[model samples]
Target: MSATTAGGEVVVRNAQGLHLRPATEFAKLAMATGCRVQVRTDAGDANGASVLELAMLGITQGVTLRITAEGPSAGDAVRRLIQLVESGFVV
Candidate 1:
């Protein structure tokens, strides 16, 4: 079998956007999934498993983020990640 890939776009709805706490949460979730994850924006792309990389994107409220995942659980991972972001990382 081959690794699968999944992706989706989500807009930041949090007032603070992706601050450290949320970024940490996002990275932790992405890492925990054990899949390759990438997050992209107009600024650029960043490794979804890296908080520093995610912060570097400078995401802000209303910014549309594109998340992609590849691996055994790509579909589920992408869906959950998109849900997380869309929910404004509200826990």
Candidate 2:
């Protein structure tokens, strides 16, 4: 895939933050994006396709996360992921 990339930042709004369930949801969406996704926080960064890594971030409410994606559909991936985060991981 080409180096197409997109990035954005979003704050955790869910009272529980990015827990296992949310991470699972996130990872699934990320994998469906057809792009490689990376999520960065003050704690660390994690592969967006990995639920364990994302949950391990221990992100709590109010934490701001930087999300970046590379490969085809990066822009759409970033936008949709940001929207998901903004929705507090609601389906």
Candidate 3:
């Protein structure tokens, strides 16, 4: 397993947060960051860039997700991802 790294967090504000479409889009955007990204919720944790794993987080509209990325571009990755999630996963 990779070492646990600290990044940032974003609270979900969308009325229909983290559903299929938004999760899918978030995963795609995260993958494009070229870093290992993961998301953590009260229930569990999962790969941030994987649609299946993200969906498994079971996040509701008002839930907060802790986002972490590790590797060379981890900072940039987290920033972009935080923005995406904060924007209701519109990206």
RMSD of each: 1.1, 1.3, 3.3
Query: In model 1, which runs have C-alpha deviations exceeding 4 angstroms?
Result: none
User: What is the clash tally of candidate 2?
Assistant: 0
Query: What's the lDDT for candidate 3?
Result: 0.83
What TM-score would candidate 2 get against the native? 0.95
Best by lDDT: 2
> Model 3 Cα displacement at 46 (Å)?
0.6
Expressed as tens digits, the lDDT of each residue in 1-91 for candidate 3 is 3433459988998888888899998889788877788899998998988889888877888788888888666777888888887887664
Give the alpha carbon lDDT tens digit for every residue of 9-73 in model 1: 99999999989999999999999888999999999999999999999888999999999999977
TM-score of each: 0.95, 0.95, 0.88
For candidate 1, the per-residue lDDT at 26 reads 98
Give the per-residue lDDT digits (tens) of candidate 2, residues 13-84: 999998899889999999999899999999999999999999888999999989999989798899999999
Off by more than 4 A, model 2: 1-3
* Shift in Å, residue 33, candidate 2: 0.1
Clashing pairs in 3: none
